[model samples]
Target chain A: MSQLANVLNITKAPQPSCQAQRLTASKSLSARQQQELRAILEQGLPQVAQPYLAIAEQINASPDQVLAQIALWQEQGLIKRFGLVVKHRQLGFKANAMVVWDIADEQVDAVAKLLSSCPEVSLCYRRPRRLPDWRYNLFCMIHGTDRAIVEAQIAAIVDKFALQAVNKDILFSVKAYKQQGARYTKKGNCHG
Target chain B: MDKQSRQATTPVAELTALDKRIINLLQRGLPVVERPFLEIAQQLGCHEDEVLERLNHLMTNKVLTRFGPMFDAVCLGGAFTLAALAVPEPEFERVTEQVNSFDEVAHNYRRSHDFNMWFVVGAESAEQVNNVINDIESKTGLPVLNTPKLEEFYVQLYLPA
Candidate 1:
């Protein structure tokens, strides 16, 4: 297999459908720090106002140093938004779904901008149209209390914006076998 | 990972090389199964305990938002749709809490626009998904706009080093 093929193979090759790029990234991190970082994040952040300082003390570093480094990572976009990852179903908001929009090639950017600006649209992205069978460029999410409410909101969006010409469908989630962050714990062990 | 590393105050705006490396590691997500941290530690050259500790710290401090599985709604089943509501600024928080009260709603956030309120709704079945939308419309007394997925595509937001 070619190099690219090899990388993509992981996602395809794994019995459980693992993404290969993850392994490749894990390989980049040396053994020691990866281990340490894993432990820290899994254990959860420290308590107290200056938690970083507490963590620094545990890891034998100054709080300032840790903060400075974290700042740099954010600037580089290595770290996405940092917040709480709650159990939606546990919270009683069980229904999960991804809504794709068949935005006019010309109106994609505009529509995406408009859609993304809404808070409920947690994640929005631009994707290439799947030729022959699929063709959608704008994607966003809408989560709410109930189905009717979700539909009502869609109706409102159509009315609010003259998107009558747009082709859209709601792909509701059947089950969420895996709904968490992408794993990268085995970067080096799996022969990258 | 040390005490400093556990501080949740590390904002995304100011990260360092080490921070970048750590964040990059984190974005990859947590491994499935027991002792997942051990795997990360083995690769990163740190103790398994250290990795877990650091993850806890980051999560506690708010430097890392969520670290868990993100489902593929299409494969999972049920209807997946996107919708937005025009929530005024003054009512954003109240509306957000009201919207969040529903269990099907996974994530709730605020955006900048007349239709400022956006959220993701998941259901056990397609019919349930639609029903949830309908309920939202009635309760809020506001129209629910549905922008379902006509075509599906995988999205990975990994920035280049």
Candidate 2:
């Protein structure tokens, strides 16, 4: 195992209760089966007539077992959402900006709620600011087909929220070095 | 090539009205059933074959990068954080290479700012996340601004095709 793996395994030692709680709350399948199912799903669900069946065949399990495990995991909130991960860049969204706002502590939640409701805003979250360097607390992303459109949207947002006095920064992506799925299983697991 | 050149060279594929509708519907999610495509076809007033064909085409053309279940890493005993490093212009490429070499570095992007190099580090625990950040700082001789998510208000991206 890699050093990272060793760290992970050591961390996993203290979380047995959490794992047990999850298992009991959603005990439709064994832990091993759940792990196998996640390993298969991390790659992606097959785009076929019987995707679950295909998954079962690959995992050497029954179709019913695979479907049941998926349903159980969804119920337990282990899976956020099973859907199409669209590549916005390929879909004509050439401009993607991570906009950060330095809002008052009392108004942060209200601002986040307003930002999340906007159609153009894809991701909205409140992150801790690093003082003496970074002071932005609320972060959201706006994607558009061009920089002009994105700027217009930002202007509209500022006008709507009366955030003219609030400090803000827009960081546009100039290049992407790596983009891929998050690895959850062990180093030599099914994910290659 | 720069951003301007890359955008100019991007292939423009003509999407029909039906294709647009399908893309919109599938983005929300697909039902977990034996014949999900059939279900989608029924909703969109189209044939299963047509739905499958358009999806296949989209994937083939790289319009839809992936289609699957997005698991919550934290729930599965993992951790992740967004970090940024401000490398001098002369050492940008070298710093990027050093940052991206780690297997834990999931996505790295060059943004328009002094803290130009922004990337996400995913590990098995919060300590591991800190370790990766520390390792990167020591390796690159630069301080990394670590900003892990304290609270997530909303996290979903739905683009109308």
Candidate 3:
């Protein structure tokens, strides 16, 4: 089939039937196979007609098995997201700020939920506060085209949420010496 | 291994209309199927090769660093932490090299704060993560403020390119 017809068929096509074999796939992936799959996927998908089939070939599995296994991972929350990882900095979102706020323990969860929903706040995580040095427990990253843009988004969030009473600080990034994917802890001993 | 190589990126390279649409659309994620790119092209009203060509161009120019499964460390039994070091200005470069030399250090950046340097250390397990942190402290001769994430409230970040 021509490329156009192949894709056009997908629009009206029913979703892949991988989920039909969900129960079997759940037990099929061994720890070693899981690790191997992770390693393989970290290499990124090939831009091909059958990316999953390509991956399955490497691990001695059928295409349907690969699709089913990946679907299982997504359901189990093992795969956080399965898509494009765009470089925001090159897209003009240079102003990156790690905004940390010391919201009270009782209220931190509520504040974090609200802060995270904002389109501007890209990453929001709650970390333990190191008292006397770092009192901030809530961290949110806002990347913008410049400082002003970032600051405005933050300010709007603060005003909208009434975070004035909360002690906060915005640590702007100066220089990135190294920025790469968090591949895993020690590829040498991932089997453990 | 398509390890997003460490290097300087071209500054805000020009993007065509389709390029932006692809970035925004893919942010939602590709369906797990045979010809995921083809599905994406259909959504954007373009040919599969055109979409593939644009993606290649974007990645080649370092616009899209990755285009695949983003696994969760905790779920995968992997360890990850965001640590900081308050390196004196004069020794910043030396300390950066020391901290970044470790394979565990995923990314290091100079943040404007008392603790000027911050980097994430990833390991296969919690014990290994601690070991990497200890190594960084001794090598740099600076106290490492360890701050592992306690809870991830939200993560998907979409920017209209």
Name the candidate that leads on DockQ. Answer: 2
**Chain B structural similarity (TM-score) per candidate:** 0.57, 0.85, 0.82
- How well is each residue in B24-143 modelled by candidate 2, as lDDT tens digits? 788667898888899999999999999889988988888876777766567777788888998899999999889988888866888999999988888888898899899999999999
The TM-scores, one per candidate, come to 0.44, 0.84, 0.82
Can you tell me which runs of candidate 3 are displaced by over 4 Å?
Answer: A1-36, A180-192, B1-9
List, residue by residue over A23-80, the lDDT tens digit for candidate 3: 3345666666666777888778776767888888888777777787788777766666
User: Each candidate's lDDT (Cα)?
Assistant: 0.49, 0.76, 0.76
lDDT of 1 by residue, B1-161 (tens): 44223222222333344434454565555433234456667767777676666656555555555554332333223345555677666775576667767766643434434455656666656688789889988878777666565432222222223
- For candidate 3, the TM-score is 0.82
Best-to-worst ranking by TM-score: 2, 3, 1
Residue A119, model 1: Cα distance from true site in angstroms: 3.0
Q: How accurate is candidate 1 locally (lDDT)?
A: 0.49
Docking quality band of candidate 3, CAPRI definitions: acceptable
Can you list each candidate's DockQ?
0.04, 0.46, 0.44
Error of 3 at B129 (Å): 1.7
lDDT of 2 by residue, A124-178 (tens): 7788889989999998889898999999999998987678999999999988776
